[model samples]
Target: MSQKTDGDIKVPSKVVVAGFISTFIEWYDFLVYGTVAALVFSQLFFPKLDAFAGTLAALSTFTVGFIARPLGGIVFGHFGDKIGRKKTLIVTLLMMAVATTGIGLLPTYDQIGIWAPIMLVVFRFFQGVSVGGEWGGVALLLMEKAAPSKRGFIGSWAQIGGYLGPLVGAGVLAVVTTFTTPQEFLAWGWRIPFLISILLFILGLWVRLVMGESHVFEKSKKAPVPIASLFRYDTKNVLGIMAVHGAQSLTLYIVIVFFAGFLKTGASFTAAQSTLSVVAYLIGATAASMFGGWLSDYTGRFKVVGAGLVLSILIAFPLFAAAATGNIYLVMLVTFTAGVACGLIYGPEPAYFGELFPTQYRYTGVSVGVQFGTLAAGSTAPIVGTFLLQWAGGGTWAVAAYLIGWQIIGLLGLMALGETRGKALEERPGA
Candidate 1:
């Protein structure tokens, strides 16, 4: 066997920064859509429905992106496992830009009627496809490049965008809404956030161009058929990862995506107010993720995620009740606190998932797990929550109960997986 050297093991700092920045940029694209859906999309795209129904309709479109994610995962993850992470990432990033810019230029239902929303959905599908393919590559880039000793802490950086993306998206929407009249904002201001993605896309593209491939991926053995190998050998690993990851997705989208709109329609808060509340949740989530990373390093990845799942169960009713009270401050507090629990789970899963499969097919396994898991969890949570509210006669209690029931499934998932903490990636096969 060939011996490893310093050059083989060391990954550059610029690549790491680019990973963080580009991850932020790509995710920012998705969050902007999320922000707009919760704010102005209902009025512009589906003005005929009642306020609640229109918001529900707009949120359903948001799910379209998540639904496309698994396909993105399959396509992108395949190439990422075949080629290298960096090249495949460039493709996904560019795809994200084109899709986001199209959304910015799309005509509204007022202007084009049915054609308008159909176009928007098409662009949104592109966004989902690109982002779906994107996360696995981005996460692997970071996790594979980082020092093995600091896998939990350093790999956690892979999700910095997880915090900043929503924060920036909501902040921008809040700014545009606060400054412009509702009429002016609806007509033009809403497009500003989407358009700003062009600049972000360009910047992220440059950083990616400057960076290189993951050191571990470059040195590892290639699977003859990555995705097939993943299913053949790692079926149990894939299912376990999906359940654990899906729990976090359900928690985040239910709160950030669904609850944001619910604040506007159910809690009677204005769009700006609802957006601001989401900002609070993102801030809490981001902070919690940072802390969770540090905590996971000391404890195990599964332990940290388990605690977060437990927290989700405990806080479901209170978090929903807090949002229902129509107090923005209380809503912010509960959202932020709940987000901390989400961070705990979100922070470690990437590193944990990366460690589960062999390097020969790590990208495909994690991407498939993360993306396919979304259908059951994040993609459907908003739609499910909205209906749950309607089923309970417009009360949050049913939604809260549904959330508790959901977490129970994730808890069971956590138990199925074994610990991977401190598992070093072996560069040489059959060592």
Candidate 2:
């Protein structure tokens, strides 16, 4: 699949697989923290607080990682634009591996007291920083490396990988917890998922090593200041990227990650039930994204995203109503439905984001735009959902209302943007 030109710059079809691996590792490390935070971090690290307070505190830590994403995008994105995608990607992987591993080694509250939570926050912040750099780099590498005609399908590999991470993390917890008691899981069993990230680290490094640098980046001129060009030449594109990406960013965390907390607190679901539902939902999300991305090649990207936003709007109340039913099967069904909606929204994003900027500033533009959206939408979503839940005394409408707002913002952003599906990467428009 690598398309090599006259000389030696051949882009392998394997770039799609490489893209999947990159996001798989990145999101796997990221989501496990949220999964555990919802299920057990409250007990392990913040046992002093009562159930509601402890859950809130734990969910807050999950948001901390998201807060650091934009900064990661800023720093790593600068270097990625100045230098190249491969080196910047290598650094992000290292940061994620180190932080994820260190998290496994941290002593719990009983052993380390306040230092446990402080250290967890510090490591989680770095994890955010690492992933902040990760998405744009991977998306750029894949979309730029791919042929224009196939960018949507190829780029969706990132979305597939994104789902794979949480899928794997949730699966691990579901299995591990099956064997251990609640007492044992809180004490030691939770560390297995974090520790297992070392294998992902090794596997990711190998895949990255086999991949070549992007031919698009290699051929493009280096901007004197890439981000400056992004702001000056492509301001609207940046905003459009944020809005187009906003809803899915928030909904993934809120509807998927936050739902686990909701199940545990309000619905009395078991940890296994919550995590297993994630496993099934992720499988559906992966398939839906691949189909969505492929379909976007035929329909315009905006149409696919617009349809998805509409679906989210229609199902907003019903999805939560299912959750409130306290029937685990019904909750899982609605989660899968939302996963389908997310896949459609997420499928076209990597290609869509890349199309928004010229090669000179693509890394910075995409990174800044996507990371800011994550900060605004992704990181804060769970917090907002939990707060709404608390305020409404466990009402689901407020959460549904929050999702509608994201969809509307994203739709507005899309309306102002032009479609760029088959456009050549070098054909930087308007800017």
Candidate 3:
């Protein structure tokens, strides 16, 4: 590994910036589907299904991608541990872009019958695979070049990709809907935003190809490459990491992906109103993510994360009640709170989990933890929320109870994990 010369550590290079750009594109492409599903998918693809059932079906497609994420992580993480981060990342980026573009061109249910939904599922699976491999590499690359004390801050940028990705996705949907009527928006305009994803893919691919490998992973030559061995020997860290991931994934998906859906159905908001409210929520999230990263730098990671989890637990019922009653001002207030909570929880997970393993197994460890959370938390939230809503006769209390349970579980997970906020990368395993 090359040592940084004087002043070289102060500024990130073009390649590092490119990593952020590439991650932003990857996340944006992945998140755009949820945005579309929330506003247009039910009408377009599941037109014949009942409203709640159609939503469940749409969310089911979204969860399918997440279900495929672990496989992607294992494949990419293995090669990344054995070969290198830069090359592996290039492949994931291309896969994600192509899959996203393909969805743009796919025929709708009106045109193709059952095959339309099947093909959509297939493309979504491709996206999941690509994203699974992408994040571990991107996070390591950025953090490797960061100054020792600034790892949390720099690592948080990878997370910023998650927040900002949705912002772009939702913002595009919001802007398109703001001017277009529902008939026009559903018939054609939704596809327009999806088609634009191709440009983002091309741009991301070019940037990722130019980025360099992480110095830390390169230097840890003796570190184990077998993911199973990492798990077998480091089971405790794996479990701890998975719990942290579960909390973050559940909270984020509920607030971001499901908010638009929940509002349209539960609160009976117009498409434009829901879009606008979600856009505002995302704006809060983007700011909160940056602030959370800064907070992790000054305070400990666990402290910030714990605060986020506890706050969610306390406010979940109130927030849902406000949104459920269809009070526009209260809805906005609660939505903003949920977004801020998501930002706070999400901002630290990448860095916090990344800090848990030896550099050689770092990619595998983080990816597995995150992937498990996708399975445990991400895949289940929408389905569970929908089911609860149905059983309770669309009562907002049902949704609130369901969400608060996850938050409490997350808080407990945080309490059990070791705090490694400022520990050196190399010193983390024994910290």
Model 3: colliding residue pairs: none
- Against the unseen true structure, what C-alpha lDDT does each candidate score? 0.81, 0.82, 0.73
For candidate 3, give the lDDT of residue 292: 79
| Predicted model with the maximum TM-score | 2
Winner on lDDT (2 vs 3): 2
State TM-scores per candidate: 0.89, 0.90, 0.87
TM-score of 1: 0.89
Tens-digit lDDT track for model 2 on 159-258?
Answer: 8988888777767877898999988988889899999889878878777777889877888788887888788888898888788788878777777778
lDDT of 2 at 349: 87
Provide the global lDDT of candidate 2 against the true structure.
Answer: 0.82
- Candidate closest to the true structure, highest lDDT: 2
Segments in model 2 whose C-alpha atoms lie over 4 Å from true places: 1-14, 38-57, 108-115, 267-277, 324-329, 390-394, 427-431
Best-to-worst order by TM-score is 2, 1, 3
Instruction: Compose the digit string of candidate 1's lDDT tens values, residues 289-387.
Output: 877877877798989989999998988988877876778899888888888888898888767888787877888889998888878887788879989
Which parts of model 1 are misplaced by more than 4 Å? 1-11, 37-59, 107-115, 264-273, 323-328, 426-431
